[model samples]
Target: MNQLKVELIVDNRVNRSTLSGNGIRNAVSLQPVLYVGGIPNNNHINLTGSGLNAYGFQGCLSSFIVDGRLLDYQRALVLN
Candidate 1:
């Protein structure tokens, strides 16, 4: 399998429920949901990004999520 590099830039204003990634928003669930062409294993999916002015509703996400599930990763970061 080949590797896929996904990039996201979420510039959010107004505190409403929405999921913004690479400039896409769901406007409902408020979680980032990325859809690829084929069904890829969650373990194979690698997520990396940054956020600011963010206070988590679930007390800050220590791990990235794929389809609303926590991902297994070596490290997690929150940059201001």
Candidate 2:
């Protein structure tokens, strides 16, 4: 099986607000689901999403799992 590394660039303040927000309130603004799919190579893979902004999120990617299995991964961004 191959592992996929997911990256998320979320607003730190918004994420914190959401974490602290009760069910009635929403923290950061809701973003569309981000999907990255591609062949795996080396230790990293390039990803693209439909709704992703040109300026990616600064926060770390969390809750990442591949095929129901969890693994440690990192992101190295290449700006174009």
Cα RMSD for candidates in order: 14.3, 14.3
Worst 10 residues of 1 by lDDT: 46-55
Candidate 1 stretches greater than 4 Å from native = 1-16, 19-61, 75-80
What RMSD does model 2 have? 14.3
Quote the RMSD, in angstroms, for model 1. 14.3
Model 1, residue pairs in steric clash: none
Tens digits of lDDT, candidate 1, 1-80: 22223333234323333233442322122344432232235523222332222222333334454455675544332320
TM-score of each: 0.19, 0.21
Candidate 2 has a TM-score of 0.21
Clashing pairs in 2: 9-57
Best by TM-score: 2
Candidate 1 accuracy as lDDT: 0.33
Q: What is the per-residue lDDT of model 2 for residues 1-80, given as tens digits with 9 covering 90 to 100?
A: 22223343344333211122122111122232223442224423222322222343344566555446554444413321
